[model samples]
Target: MRGIRSLNHLPKRCYAAARRSEALTVPLAGIKPSSATPLPPQNVQVSKLPNGLVVASLENYSPTASVGVFVRAGSRHETVENQGVSHVLRLAANLTSKGASAFKLCRGMEALGGSLSVTSSRETMVYTADCLRDNLGTLLEHLVNVTAAQEFRPWEVSDLTPRVKIDKALAQQCPQIGVIEKLHEAAYKNALSNSLYCPDYMVDHVSSDMLQSFVKDNFTTGRMALVGLGVDHSVLRQVAEGLLSERSGAGAPVAKALYRGGELRVQNNEALVHALIASEGGVTGSAEANAFTVLQRVLGAGPHVKRGSNITSKLSQGIAKATAQPFDATAFNASYSDSGLFGVYTISQADSAGEVIKAAIAQVSGVAEGTVSEADITRAKNQVKADYLMSLESSETLLEEIGAQVLATAAYQLPDSVLQAIDAVTQDDVVKAAKKFVDGKKTMASSGHLTNTPFVDEV
Candidate 1:
């Protein structure tokens, strides 16, 4: 299973050549051959059990499998009092399994040679198991036990309390994660986006009784999506039917929520100043959202520290006053249910922090004004399209892509169609996306040595 982290081992000379070309020329326009791209995925099968849980499957010949139990209960669903319940739910899933004690649950999975993990985002909470196909049953049985009937014991909650608090503190110290949290806070400060990771205060508030109530409210059959990759969905469905069909609770609220934007700065002890500049972008369905993705690739893709292209140079210059040591910058196009975050982040020396932000803003402004040449668009499109296609080579990524599409939209869409749509975007579309920030309101969060300098004022 080749990964983006692995493909990064290509020769330095290749990156050097790419870096040398600064003239925003569209080399792909006339040279690269254009033909219809065959959709790589065979197809996806989606069905619902009598209990209302979605069962999705995609087959791969690989000897490995990835099984996930996805629930539409996460940070976005929390009120101020229940802020970190989503995180607690994810953690609790790992500690106990169906009618089994925590110790037994851990030992069973370890004996089966399986890896169990869980993560939460704004929209969903996922519990995953990755292992050889031979151990699929053992894994699924344990997963069903944990998700559907685990007991949130008092001792278990007490033991995990300190660990969760430590994690919260660690998140605050890391510049990259801190900046992202801040940017999201700026965009949806009072709603789901603002409090994706429950604060320590919220974690302390999560008693054993609270865990049971939280799980009862959120982890319901009606609000769940069961995803199995590289394994038979029908087999999983038959085996797990009794467990997931148990009635638990209703679906989450689907009404529109409000979000506001402004500067949100949090000072922390780190050498570099980390800045996350964020602006609202369209959600997944809009044409503007697709265009913004292309824009993100052009400016944020590839290894800037090692590849060092013109776009990277602009970022480096922006953060020049901070530190002489090299740092990284990335533009993230994170999609939420109602809106998106077109964010750019930089880790640079604290001294040049203000200059770095100004330079980044200028670069964004230039792209919005259509200063980017056709070549930039062509190369960016190809890079994004090719990378996205290549990701499907692995069963894990393939499954994630399928599930993500289904989660974002009700129907399954081919990745090639998505690529084609991205390729169709012109410089004008890119400019429009860039204008969402350059000429519109923006939000930001910064940590590290940022007290002496401030971000450029928006007019």
Candidate 2:
């Protein structure tokens, strides 16, 4: 009887399975695909508040959003009395603010699945916050507190000394960083000569009063730009008008960066030599700067392929012929608001450093003498355009780009415009840029086994 019952149920099960398979192959009778229209893309909208704060935002409609407070209080703004204050202030971002305690600030950001970070360069300090779009309001409040409402308690500021030392120690581990810092120190007469790290004497000595005074002098509305991505422009404007308008006026006069060529060398027993030789190039956002940028790509800014030799680089080709040792060479171009540095950076075995450095500079000389072809210029322009476009694809980089431009020019140049500017660089313009670097006063910074490295004047 049990076998008979099982046999009877088997036919019904088979029928049900057949029906399910049929259902899997076909759509249901009444289901329909979505008919809603997609939203139109929004361009970056920029406006200024009555208090002189620049507000810029783009509605990318992304799930994640980012906002940054860009202030002109970089190392360049530091005075002789406040050297390394910016470095200490960068580490003090998470300290208790006027509106929130340090503990609450940390926990609030964590609860919202967000992050806040502070990064400074020679000319700017950016306080950036990232969070989901739904929780952007809460995260943005934290950013405001960090940038505008800081208390900088003495004990908390004192606690940042160890971190500052760690930063300097870690930077010491990288020869590239040391060389760059030395380059800046050697390149400028006054404003631009400041190092990004805290000096040894000022590491624990950057007092709370100093931080507060620095903020009071530099974090004014006129010197700040509030920028955001994947956000509503009006909301950003409201935040700027409401909370960020406290420091209304231009707080202090800015001193222009003066470029004076010199040299700084560090003698060490390391097996490798890192050398940078530069000349005054072009101011930021100028046509000359664009040419310098194109020239950088022509000489090869860096390897396009990861861990691959830049065989196509003129610097690499030139240096490879001069020495058989393993070496890396690339063009280095840094443009600031008032000045720029254009040069070649080379790293080679200590014994081959002189040959590598001379060869790298000789490549620039070749370009200055019209050795570069129209084809080279075209390829470099393409590279510049591609790099600029690719950088904007990331939300974080895009925010930074927008902030930098707005802070500098009080306006944004569209990508098409930027590409057009890059394309407008003629072969003659590149040659002229090369000639400027070849003829201008040079600043050199090198580390590791100076016995083989050439001096600035020698190069």
Best by lDDT: 2
In TM-score terms, which candidate is top? 2
Question: Model 2: residues >4 Å from true position, as ranges?
Answer: 1-31
**lDDT digits (tens) for residues 116-226 of candidate 1:** 888788777778888888888888888888788868877877677777877787776666787788777766755646465668567667778777776777788778777
lDDT of 2 at 278: 97
Give the residue spans of candidate 1 off by over 4 A. 1-42, 248-250, 268-271, 302-328, 455-459
TM-score of each: 0.83, 0.93
Give the 10-residue window scoring lowest on summed lDDT in candidate 1: 313-322
Overall lDDT per candidate, in order of appearance = 0.72, 0.92
Q: Provide the lDDT at 301 for model 2.
A: 86
lDDT for each residue of candidate 2 in 372-446, tens digit (9 for 90 to 100): 999999999999998899999888899999999999988999999999999899999999999999999999999
Model 2 TM-score is: 0.93
